[model samples]
Target: MSFEWPWQYNFPPFFTLQPNVDTRQKQLAAWCSLALSYCRHHKLYTLDIMEAQESPVFNHKNIDRKLSMEAILIVFEELRKKGNLEWLDKNKTRCLVMWRRPEEWGKLIYQWVSKNGMVNTVFTLYELANGDDTESEEFHGLEDWMLIRSLQALQMDGKAEVISMDDGKGVKFF
Candidate 1:
């Protein structure tokens, strides 16, 4: 699937940080939206600052414009404040991006289980993510860390329980 770039992406001025506070705020907002949409379309759960700077989303080769590293940091910082990103290191080079919150993912999983009448059934993490039954599901191909977080969200709501077994971890939906 191809990601559609926002209109701002092609605007050369959008690549630079604006001197005006209000303009900068609007610019940052646009950047945050673009970044989240791009990551979601690519199914990217993690991001590296250097890698992102080179990615098409931030680098508009057609326009010969690229967002400055400092601007990217500001955009990411905004995302973090909005609860959509989490830094993974002190250097802030790597981060986890949550386009959809764990609670939202948990709700989707729970709804699927209920709709399929699979409630009360134990399912291995792999099965939920990569099993044939879930191949056509949105959560299919979900990374284990994100999967665990989604299950944990469900557990907090008393809709699911994560079990650690000898073979691996599993989950039981209530």
Candidate 2:
């Protein structure tokens, strides 16, 4: 499915950083929503600023408009502040985007496990993400880091426990 761009994405002025405080704040909010939804739809867990600039979400080819580097940085910063993004480096070149928080992912996983009567079962991280049984699940193909985080969230809730083994990491649901 094609990603749906926000109304502001097609507006020329939206590409430029607004000088007015209120307008800029609203602009950043729109940008943050767009970025998160775009990443979620594409299953993009990480973003590099350089790569993102060329992406359709940040570059509106139809309108011949693109968000400037400064504006992109500002938007990313806003996302970070909202707890939906985490910078991966001090230079702020790369970041992890979380449209669905770990806790939310954890809840989905637990629900699936409960539905399948898989409680008290031990599953390798790979099995949970790439196993045939999970192929039809929303969490299928999830990145390793994100998967681990989701399990950790479950662990916090006492619904799951993460186990480390020689081969790799595993999880046991309660």
Displacement of the residue 3 alpha carbon in candidate 2, Å? 1.4
- The TM-score measured for candidate 2 stands at 0.97
lDDT of each: 0.93, 0.93
Per-residue lDDT of model 1, residues 51-90, tens digit only: 9999998898999999889889999999999999999999
Tens digits of per-residue lDDT for model 2, 66-157: 99898899999999998999999999999999999999999999999999999999999999999999999999988999999999999999
Quote each prediction's TM-score: 0.96, 0.97
Candidate 1 similarity to native, TM-score:
0.96
Which residue ranges in model 2 land beyond 4 Å of their true spot? Answer: none
